[model samples]
Every structure is written in C-alpha cells, then in structure tokens.
Target: MSQLKEIIYNCKKATSLIERKEIGRLTLRESVELKIHLAFCSVCRIFRRQSITINSMVKMLFNDAQQRQTKLDDTFKKSLQERIEDKLNKNGKKL
Candidate 1:
C-alpha cells in the first residue's frame, strides 16, 4: 500500500514513533508502522537502538545524580547542625 510505503520512508515520523514506543505512548497504528519501517530499514533500526541506549543512559545518570544529591543533602544538614551546636556550646548557651 502507498500509505505503508510512505510510512516506511518517513524518517522524522519514525524517529518520533520510536520515542513514543519506548514510553508506551504510541497508538497501535503508529506502533505497527514503526515496526514495519524498522523491519525493512536498517538506518531507522539503528537509530531506534541508539535512541533506546541514550534514553537508558540518561535515566541511569539522572537517578544516580538524584541519589548523590540526597546523600549530600543529608550530610550537609548534619554538618550544619553540628556546627551550630558547637557554636552554641562555645557561647555557653544550652541546646
């Protein structure tokens, strides 16, 4: 079908569809079109895999950053509390 051929050749649409596919946002027709395109198009297939890899790497890095930030925040809070307590004790103030 000409529509299928058009879908297969649509690089931009295919790329967006790949992203949608990763997030489960693609409609059934879009999923089918993307699958059919990938089956016959090496370039689009490689792009899809690379996009998946990049998305995974980004997610992993973001999670790692969040964890590190949380740890640092806790450490900072504890250090600040200790400093305040030390200052209060030096000034002969209770608690």
Candidate 2:
C-alpha cells in the first residue's frame, strides 16, 4: 500500500494506534504516522475521542472505586483487570 494508505490502515489497526497510544507510548514513527492519519481520517478521529473518553471514565471510576474499596466488587475488578491484560498483551508488554 501507499504510505498514507498504510498509515490510515495502521491507524485502524488494534484498539487503534491512537487508542493504544493513550494507555502507553508510541514510537516516533508511529506517533508521526498517527498524527498524519488523524489529520485526514474522520473515522479514526472519532475513534480517538471515544478512546480518550473511555479511558478517562475508567480512570475516574477505578480511582473512586479504589478509594471506597467497597462498591467495586469482584466482577468489576476482574473485568478491569482483563481489559488491562488484553491491552498489555496486544501491545506485547507485560505487567
């Protein structure tokens, strides 16, 4: 594929390079590519905002739950843990 097409396609990959970027870091090349993709791809742009909002909500909820240490319960904790694990695994990182 052409470089821009590849970049757009890459932006669509995984939770999206843009989304993965919020939870972690991206290489210089990947970051540059994503910025380029976001400049033009409206779909990825929307996905970018959604990912950021989801992350913010999760962090807010998780922090509140942690402070209370009462309302979270096992299911919520387990689901959050699984989501974290999945993200890490997809990124080839380890906790």
Candidate 3:
C-alpha cells in the first residue's frame, strides 16, 4: 500500500523521530511509523544504534564530571574575594 511505502521509506523522518524519541516519548503514530521504518531500513537502524550509544556516552561523561567537581578552599576564596574588593576600591566602584 502507499501508506506502508511512505512509512517504510522516509529515512529523514525516521531519523528525526529517533532523536525525538531519545529526548521524549513519541506520539503513537510517530512511534509506529518509526518502528516500521526502522524495521525495513538497515541504515536507519544503524543510525539509531549509534545515536543511542553517543547519548549514553555523553550522559556518563557529564555524570562523572559532576561527581568529581571540586571547590576552592575557604582561605583561597577569601583571598580571591579580598583581591577583587581591593581592585574595585582602587577603581572607585562602591560595593
């Protein structure tokens, strides 16, 4: 049928739906269309797999960065603040 052909042959729409599904749930129509397209399209299937892998890797990197975040010591912070205030005072900026 023409509808089936349309659903299975639109690689551009299929890829867009794949990315959209990654960020949020697709509508029932979009979900069905994407599933149909992916089933028939090997390139699109490979693209979807690569997209999922890249997303997972990026999420892991961000989580690791957040977990290892550090802050300046209180002494260092105070010293930096004092230096900033001194510069502002010298520049005639009220704080």
Which candidate's TM-score is highest? Answer: 3
Off by over 4 Å in 1: 69-95
- TM-score-better candidate, 1 vs 2: 1
Q: What is the C-alpha local distance difference test score of candidate 2?
A: 0.78
When sorted by TM-score, best at the front, the candidate numbers are 3, 1, 2
TM-score per candidate, in order?
0.66, 0.60, 0.71
Score candidate 3 by TM-score against the native.
Answer: 0.71
TM-score between candidate 1 and the true structure: 0.66
For candidate 2, the per-residue lDDT at 51 reads 79
Give candidate 3's error at residue 62 in angstroms.
1.5
Question: Residue by residue across 10-87, what tens digits does model 3's lDDT show?
Answer: 899999999999999899999999988988999999999999999999999999989998787999999999999889
Stretches of model 3 off by over 4 angstroms after superposition: 70-79, 83-95
Q: Write the per-residue lDDT of candidate 2 for residues 1-95, one digit (tens) a residue.
A: 89778776664463467766887899888788878878878887788788789889989999998888766688989999999888988999754
Candidate 2 vs candidate 3: the TM-score winner is 3
Model 2 TM-score, 2 decimals? 0.60
